[model samples]
Every structure is written in C-alpha cells, then in structure tokens.
Target: MKNVEIYIKSTCSFCVKAKNLLKQNNIKFKEIFVENSTANLSKMIKRSKKTTVPQIFINKVHIGGYEDLIIFLKKNI
Candidate 1:
C-alpha cells in the first residue's frame, strides 16, 4: 500500500488533475489543502521545497509536482 500525501490549492487545475489521476488509479491519498490558509502553504513549501500546488509524496518521500507524479506512476505503477 502506498501512503500518499498531496498538498494542493483548492482552485489549481493541476491540483485537480493530479487528484483525478490518483483517483483513477485507486490510489488513496491524504489531501493537504493550502488554498485557504497561508500557514498550510508555507508548510508544504518547507516540506517539498516547492511553492506549487499538487506537491506530492509517497511513503513520506517527496515526489515533486503533477508531472513528476506521472513519471513516478509510469515507472512504478
């Protein structure tokens, strides 16, 4: 089982696309919403070193953004 976590801004299209992909694959992920709060956004940036929505992690390992997630899924799934 993959312990997946994704940090997302509520209105980002990339975030929605990333989530759809995860759902399509039946990969249950914990979504950390950062759109409505600055603190959550900062935490995501600190954790992933990226100031972008859809920052993804699997098994506590940082996996970058939506495009990166596609690569990861292609190689691993």
Candidate 2:
C-alpha cells in the first residue's frame, strides 16, 4: 500500500467516517489533526486549495476529501 495521509479536524463527523472507511479496508494512514493549529490548517489549504477537513492524500498526490476518497478507493483499492 502507498503512504496514506489524512488531514482531519477534531469533532468532524466526516473525518471519523473517512477514517472508519480506511480502517475497514485495512489501510494504515497518518492522521494529521488540524483542529488546534493554524499552521496545519493553512498547510492543508495550501496543498488542497480547499478549506475543509478530511483532506486526504496518497503518496503525496492529493486525493481530495471524503467522497473523493470513496471514489478513489472504489477504483484503486
């Protein structure tokens, strides 16, 4: 498996769902929490060009948010 990274905000339901999905698929991911730090959130926006939690990446390539992750999983997982 490729390196999976997920940027998540605390208390975000979509983030939980996304992590759950990954776990169900037995995918190990690095969880980046951006709920308390501005720098992390800013980095997420800079990388994804979107101000949203649960921003996912695979091997340094942007895989987008929750629904996008689902699609990617369906096609490639």
Candidate 3:
C-alpha cells in the first residue's frame, strides 16, 4: 500500500465516510483536520486547488474526494 493522507474537516460527513471506508479496508492513513489548522488548509488548497472537506492523496498524488477515493479503492484494492 502507498502512503495515504486525507485532508478533512471534522464536521464533514463525507470526511467521516471516507475515513471509515479506509478503516474498513484496513488501509492506514494520516488524517489532517483542516478546520483545526490554517497551515494545513492552506497546503491542501495549494495542492488540490479546492475548498472541499476531504481532499485525499495517495503516494503524494491527489486522488480527489470521497467518491474518487472509493473508485480508486475499487480499482486498486
């Protein structure tokens, strides 16, 4: 498995769902809460160019949000 990171806001249902999916699949991930930190949010935006809640990355490549992650899992997992 590749190194995975997910940029998320705490209150976002999509973020929760995404994390849950990763957990269910036994995929370890590093999660950063964008709501609690400005620097991380800034980095997320710089990297993804989006203000969405759950910006996911796999192996340093942006994989988009929850739905995209699901699709990626279907193909990779």
- Rank all candidate structures by their lDDT, best first, as comma-separated numbers: 3, 2, 1
Candidate 3 lDDT trough over 10 residues, lowest sum = 1-10
How does each model score on lDDT?
Answer: 0.92, 0.93, 0.94
- Give per-residue CA lDDT, model 3, range 1-77, as digits (tens): 67999998889999999999999999999999899899999999999999997999999999999999999999997
The numbered model that scores best in lDDT is 3
Stretches of candidate 2 off by over 4 Å are none
Q: Which tens-of-lDDT digit does each residue in 6-65 have in candidate 1?
A: 999888999999999999999999999998889988999899988988999999999999
Off by over 4 Å in 3: none
State the displacement of the C-alpha of residue 61, model 1, in Å, after optimal TM-score superposition.
Answer: 0.5
The C-alpha stretches of model 1 lying farther than 4 A from their native spots are none
lDDT of 3 at 23: 95
